[model samples]
Target: MTDITDAAKRLLLGKPMSSERLGHTLLPKRLALPIFASDALSSVAYAPDEILLTLALAGVAGTIWTPWVGLAVVLVLVVVVASYRQNVHAYPSGGGDYEVVTENLGKNAGLAVASALLVDYVLTVAVSISSASQYVASVFPALRGSEVIVAISVVVFLTFMNLRGVKESGKAFAIPVYMFMGAIGLMAMFGFFQYLTGSLGEAESAGFVLTTSEAYDQGLVGLGGALLFARAFASGCAALTGVEAISNGVPSFKRPKSRNAATTLLMLGTISASMLTVILLLAMETGVKYAENPAEQLRTVSGGAIPDDYVQHPVISQLAEVIFSGAPWLFMLVSAVTGLILMLAANTAFNGFPILGSILARDGYLPRQMHTRGDRLAFSNGIMTLATGAIVLIWVFDAQVTKLIQLYIVGVFISFTLSQLGMVRHWTGKLRKASDPRERSSMRRSRVINVIGFLLTGTVLIVVLITKFTHGAWITLLIMALLFLLMRSIRKHYDSVIEELALGDDLAAARALPSRVHAIVLVSRIHKPTMRAVSYARATRPSVLEAVTVGVDENEIATLQAEWQKMDVPVPLRVLNSPFREITRPVLSYVRSVRRQSPRDLVVVYVPEYVVGHWWEQLLHNQSAIRLKSRLLFTPGVVVSSVPWQLSSSQGHGVETTYFPQSGQPPAMEDRKR
Candidate 1:
């Protein structure tokens, strides 16, 4: 069974690499771009849709502002990337926003930033995969209503790919991500060329006008219109979702990690900004109309209401349809790669979240299991956790990109604001300690850049909260607060444990000898195993030894008493009755009572257990003895030991005849067969 399982694992994930070979997995810049930058670049698929969807609440006039909103988003993206480049250089420890905030702002602030970024990473996976499923469903209309299942399956696939090792997954994803980029670039360039030649055409939906909600039917003539545009700007900021992944993953880069990370950050910002700009312009020029509910919000040019079956495709789909007009394959190719890239975008979060989780776990803020690397050198616990959280979000939102998107950007902006604030303080502190003129001037310039980042992200945070709080952003804030408190509690527990373990001048107390030894063998039935336990306890030469049993059934206790007397054992037999028929509680109470009477005396308990060659036979015996031994260990001044008697079924299995089960024994089988 073990050989088959191992062979399957090797076939699925390749040969398991050793810890010494971990450095062989460090990524080059080309692979790192797809692994780290896909999320930010792929947001072009949905960021424009969000901009158009939110703007559609007002009227067709509202869609005209898509370019300006895209520009604002681009500017914020630039500042964030520049500020994080400074972070990767200064703190190249790969702590990312959490490290920066923790170092400059102290532990509590750092915990807050960690909590926010952790939440952000999970949402990045959810939003990206959900949007990708939308694109896929657009290409295949038969899958329209089952997007949730498709999104979840893609998430599981990504999790398996990531668990294979970071560089392995990076190489696997590089081509599709680059193909996506080239496809978008080619589509946009061809689109513009045709526009210059006066042959560019409108979207299929361009003829059908979008009717605004009653509140905005007048079209940008009131105070409500201004608030709607602000909301649109806030939603479009989704393009910056994965911008911090490069900073968080500096350690994964090859030799010059910091320099490579900075370069990657610059490239990510540039490509994302350009793609977002081009997509927004194409949507505006082609008059692509996307509404939250197209059946009700859309009508014919002759003023008739559209049918309820009308489906509103996203901005990119609409643009691809027009740009690749005659060439069906080009449109299909663009659609296929677009869907794949959107799904693969979650890989950036997969790469970043686990590394950050390891850092947090090492700092005692999360479970220690997360700190350990798997055979593939990935944080296996963190990967599983991210997958679980993203799947839950996908399930809750029914894989609707528009609804899940409402919960996006809040956590990223939180990390962004805190990270920039930390950078400003970092540079300021450096300038104060530096005496060199050149270094001082350099610090001054970096400080100005971080300050701008701080202001920009801070204002966007307020706008996001005010516009999206009631919609879904508050759920993110609540999750962040809960995570912050949970991490604090974990740290408090680890600190208390450390304090308790600090050996002081109490060595004399630990070395004190006990007054006497009392040996008690826990007997379940008068069998060979019980006789062996009784014989072993008597030979120990203790001050006093006796056989003890819990009376679970009256008739069974009577039979055991008769058999013990027939054996003529030297030790006395004591039977404790349980009116409620419990084993562990009665034994625990009796052991504690002995310690309460004589605090200095040591109580030793010997439990008789069965060792069977076959797995199922072992479960048939030693049930009560195991529980009693466990309960006795927790009693003060007590030592619990097990004595094993090999059953006849164990003779031919090359058994070790040990008292305890082997550590490699399958725990699930014990639980199931027992």
Candidate 2:
């Protein structure tokens, strides 16, 4: 069963990649763009809708702020992208925010950034997959309420693709990303032309009168109203969610790594901002309206409430329908590309999470398995972890993009603020050391840009916290705090182990030798394995040698004793009685007594174990031998060795066999000849 499972996994995930081939997987800029930028680019799909939905809580009257909110998000996106371009250029080691914060702010601050980025990566998958499922549901109404299941399945599919390798995933994602850009870009262009010509028609929701719920029925009137406007802006900042991914993936780029990474970051910023602005503009031109509770808040021209089953589609879907008005196929194409890009957007997290995780692992903050590349030279462990987290979040939130979005940008902005602060410090330090005039000017210029970025993102971070805390962002902060404590504890553990094992002043401890050697061979019966272990242990020429076996049955012990005498074995056969029919305990007791008798001597326990070819055959024998060795290992002044005798069933298998000098053969062969 184990073998089959392993084989199936290999077939699904492909064969393991060798360490030498990692360099071969480096991504060119075109492919790198999609792998690292898809998350940011795809956020355009939902960011505008988020802005409109939040504003619509005050009825259609409050929805006029959509353009201004999108502008604020776009401005912030540009500064962040510019700031991270410097990051990719300066610290192209793929540590991203963690390395920058650590180098400038200190270890604790760096861990804070690391925790935030880790959380962001997880939320990226959850939000992107959930949003993608929403688009899928928009296209196929039959799958409407099954959003959580669909989101989880897509996460699994993306996880499988990423496990295949970075380069492979990038290739697969590039087409949809570009297609999405072309489709949306053309739709935006056409929608704008029609708006300019005064020929554009109103959206389907243009006629519906939105009545603000009782909670906000007064509509944009005081300090409470002002905070509501700011909250909408904060939510719209979801457009900036993936700007840091390029910095985290700098090392994955091909030749001129830093430059390619910086260029990619620039492209990501431009494309995402463009798409976001266009979508919001088109939604306005098409008069697209949304409501928090469509069944209640939405009313027809005659003032009747819409049915509970009325499905309110997203802003982009509504715009696509108007832009491709007569061409149904093109509308379907728009939806397909939107859904495809959103699903693949999780690929950005797949790329960034593993690289950052590998860096964290190297620093001893996470498990070492995260540091190793998988069969395809990707961080498979980290990929699986991100997928698992996303699956849980999708299930919990029931695949609602709005709920996930509240938790999404908090970590990302936290990272953005810290990373920008680090860059400011980085530039200031460089400025202090520079003697050349041109270099000094460059440093000062970079410092100014970083300072602007720090201020913008820091404000956004505060806004996100104050505006979104009660709405689910607090959960993200709590998880980050817990992760911070856990990482610090792991670092403390690794540090303590290093300090204890340093061996700085004690050379004698390293060269200590045993005063004497006492070797014992463990046996179940006078079989080939037992004889082989006895032969191998005797070759060591210890001060003492004995063959020990537990007598679980008297008749078997008698037969073994008779055969031992008949064979005239060179060593003494000492049988121990197991009153409880226990194998490991009695042997442990005997070894401890021997050590008690001779404190300075080393007792080497040789355990005879069978080697089998097939997985099922492993259970047929030597199960007790494995347990005996494990217990013996912790005993003071003891060494345990396994002497494996290959059974005839092992032929043609790849389990390595080493022939020890003159280990015994099965005595049954000699008996048969007699």
Candidate 3:
């Protein structure tokens, strides 16, 4: 069974590589761009839709400001990218936001950043994959209602690919990512070229009139409009979700890791900014209309409602239809790659989350298992964990990107604001110690950039919380707060355990020998297993030894005594009465009595257990012995030892018998011979 499972694993993940091969897995700049920047770049596919959707509430008058909102988003993206470049250079250990905040702001502040980033990474996968499924469904209308299933399937696929190793996944994803870039770049250039030549046509949704909601009938005129614009801006800032991934993944790059990572960050910011600008510009120019409910929010010029079956395509799809109308194949190609890139964007989170989880685990905030590398040298446990989280969110949200977007960006901005604030502190501390003139000037410049970054991101964070809190952002904040408390509790536990296990000047006293050793063998009947336990107890050469059992029935006790006399057992047997047929409590009471009789004695309880081969056989045997062993383990100065008698069915399963010493020293050679 084990061999079959291992074969399946090898088929899926390939053979295990040696730890020395880790360096060989380092990504080059070309590969790292796609691996770490896909999320930020793919935001182009959905960020514009979110911006337009939020504005559609105020009707067409509000939608005209889409370009300005996108530019605002781009500005924040630029500052965040620049700020994180400093982070990667200064803290190349790949701690990213959590490390920066922890070192500069303190542990509690750092934990806050960690909690936010962790929640953000999960949402990144959920939102990205869910949007990708939308694109897929748009192209294949038959799959429209099954987006949740499709998104989950894609997540599973990506998880397995990542488990194969980071570099391997990077190589596989590089082509599709570059193809997406080319497709979008070509579409943008074609759209602009057609616009310059006075040949670009309006989108299919252009003829429809967007009706304003009653709350915004005045349209971009007062306090309500201002709040709506801020909401739009906050929604557009989804473009910045994946910027910190580059900083979190610095160690994955080749030699000169920090420089490569920073370069990638610059490239990501440029490409994402350019893509977002072009998409939004073309969306507005071509008169693309997207709404939360198109059937209700859209109307004809005569003030009549549109058809109930009308499907409001995403902004990019509408733009593609208008820009690439002449070349149907080009439109399909763009749509396919857009979907592919959105799905691949989750790769950024997959790369970032595991590394950050490992850092948290190393710091004793998460389970220690999260810190270990798997067979493929990936944080396989963290990858699986992130996938599970994303899957749950996808299932619960029904893969609705619009609803999920309301919950997005809040956590990223929290991390962003705190990270930039930490960078400011980091550079300030550096400036005080730097006496060199050139270094001081550089530190001062970096400080200025981070300060601006902090201001912009902090404002955006506030806007996000205010505009989105009632719209689903509160769910994210609640999760982050819960995670923060959970991590703090875990750290406290780890610290308490460390304090308890710390050896002091009384080490010799802790290791002092007991005055006497008392051995007890638990028996059910005079069988080979019981005799084996008795023989092992006698070999221990304790000061006192006895065989004990629970007498549930008088007839059974009499039969056991007859068999014991027939076998001429050397050890005296004592039976404890149990009117209720309770096995564990009586054994525990007897062990305590023995300990009370000799206060300074060590009691070793030898339990006879049946070793079975198949899993089902376990349910049929060793039921009483298992319960008694668990109870005996907590008694003071008591040791529970198991003497296994392998059944006939257990043979040919590679099972072996070995002796283990309870003491801290190796057993004598004579014991080994026995």
Specify the highest-TM-score model's number: 3
In candidate 3, position 33 carries an lDDT of 96
Residue-wise C-alpha lDDT for candidate 2, range 1-674, written one tens digit per residue: 44677798888778887889989899998899888889889988888888888888888767877888889989999998888878888898889999999999999999999999999999999999999998999899899889999999999999999998888888888999999999998898788898899878788788888777555677877776677788888988888877888888888899799999988888888899989989888888888888667777789879998766678888888888877888888889899899989999999999899999999999999988999887778889999999999899999999998888888788988999999999999999998889999989988888898999999999988888998999999999999999999999998999999998787877897678888899888877887777777767777787999888898899999998899989898888889999889989999999999999999899988887787877788888778988897888899899887777788877645435565432233323232232
Better of 2 and 3 by TM-score: 3
Give all TM-scores, in the order shown. Answer: 0.91, 0.94, 0.96
For candidate 1, write residues 16-135 as lDDT tens digits.
789999899999999999999999999988889999999988778888777888889999999889988889999998899999999999999999989988999999999999999988
Give the deviation of candidate 3 from the true structure as CA RMSD: 2.3
> In terms of TM-score, how similar is model 2 to the real structure?
0.94
- Which regions of candidate 2 are displaced past 4 Å? 1-11, 14-17, 613-620, 647-650, 655-674
Clashing pairs in 3: none
Rate residue 491 of model 2 by lDDT.
85
Q: Tens digits of per-residue lDDT for model 3 on 1-674?
A: 65677899999999999999999899999999999999999999999999999999999999988988998999898888888888999999899999999999999999999999999999999999999998998889999899999999999999999999999999999999999999999998999999999999999899899999998999988999999999999999999989989888988999899999999999999999999999999988898888888888889889899987888877888888889998888888888899999999999999999999999999999999999999999999999999999999999999999899999999999889999999999999898899999999999999999999999999999999999999999999999999999999999999999998888779898798999988888888877777767767777678888888899999999999888878888788899999999888898998999889888999988888887878899999999888887778788889988887778877756446654434323333443454
RMSD of 1: 4.4
* Evaluation by lDDT, superior candidate among 1 and 3: 3
Model 1, stretches more than 4 Å misplaced?
Answer: 1-15, 307-309, 511-517, 531-544, 552-572, 578-582, 610-622, 642-674
The weakest ten consecutive residues by lDDT in model 3 span: 659-668
